[model samples]
Target: MNSWVNASKFFTGASTVGSIAIPAILKHAGIIGWGALAMELSSFFIFVIAIMCYMSMYDEDGYSSMI
Candidate 1:
């Protein structure tokens, strides 16, 4: 749907800016190495949470349509 497309675009743009800005901000504070580590750990946790959420969406009886 158009709404989904727009939402995806917005998130993609926001994350792109954040990916660039966050590291620069950390570098300015003189801790770029630790910042990169923190970002990686956060990304891993987010991936795990997304997988859990997707798994939870299925009905116990079997697969079900969200729509």
Candidate 2:
């Protein structure tokens, strides 16, 4: 369970980084619009907020699952 959770966290971190980086890469390559970037930024913040909420549902010892 711990391994799976850790792997999920790792992938989430990677995806968060990619969410920032891939947009920039696409814009630089002229494949996306400004509106698309704006949408991505908004969605990323929402994703972060959801992650924070999920984390806060657990206690410091990380034993409680209440999300």
Candidate 3:
């Protein structure tokens, strides 16, 4: 679990750096809009997946109890 947590942190940091760097690289290449759109979609999918994972942590009974 600790290893997983450390790996997650490392990837999260790499993701942050890439998010900052990729746009500028794309803009220099003359595809800023396309690159930005792709990044936005990627972020949205990551968000959805994170939400799904969070929801899955709750059992059926636990989910019902939320309401």
Candidate 4:
């Protein structure tokens, strides 16, 4: 299908281009140093918070359209 093909292309492009930048960003942020574990845990918490915020938009009683 066209959607699958497009998704594959996008994933491939992102994997090739975006993957390299992660290491550079981590190094610059000292995430690869002594505080790596703490930084990783903090990042996980941030991701969870963002997910909670996003999911709150779909709360059943909060918004009729979102439900």
Model 4 over residues 1-67: C-alpha lDDT tens digits? 9999999999988864555556557778876864664566566568769989999877777557674
lDDT of 1 at 65: 45
RMSD of each: 5.4, 5.2, 5.6, 6.5
Cα deviation of 43, candidate 1, in Å: 16
Give the best candidate by lDDT: 2
Candidates arranged by TM-score, highest first? 2, 1, 3, 4
- Point out where model 3 deviates above 4 Å: 33-67
Candidate 2 clash pair list: none
Better of 1 and 4 by TM-score: 1
How well is each residue in 1-67 modelled by candidate 1, as lDDT tens digits?
A: 9999999999989986776677668767887687585776577568769989989975676645443
lDDT pick, better of 2 and 3: 2
Candidate 2: stretches off by over 4 Å: 1-12, 60-67
The TM-score of predicted model 4 comes to 0.43
lDDT of 2 at 25: 91
Clashes of each: 0, 0, 0, 0
Worst 10 residues of 2 by lDDT: 58-67
Model 1 clashing residue pairs (backbone): none
Rank candidates by lDDT, best first: 2, 3, 1, 4
In candidate 3 the C-alpha lDDT for residue 62 amounts to: 63
Report the C-alpha lDDT of model 3 over 7-33, residue by residue, as the tens digit.
Answer: 999998998777767776777788768
Q: Model 1 misses residue 51 by how many Å? A: 25
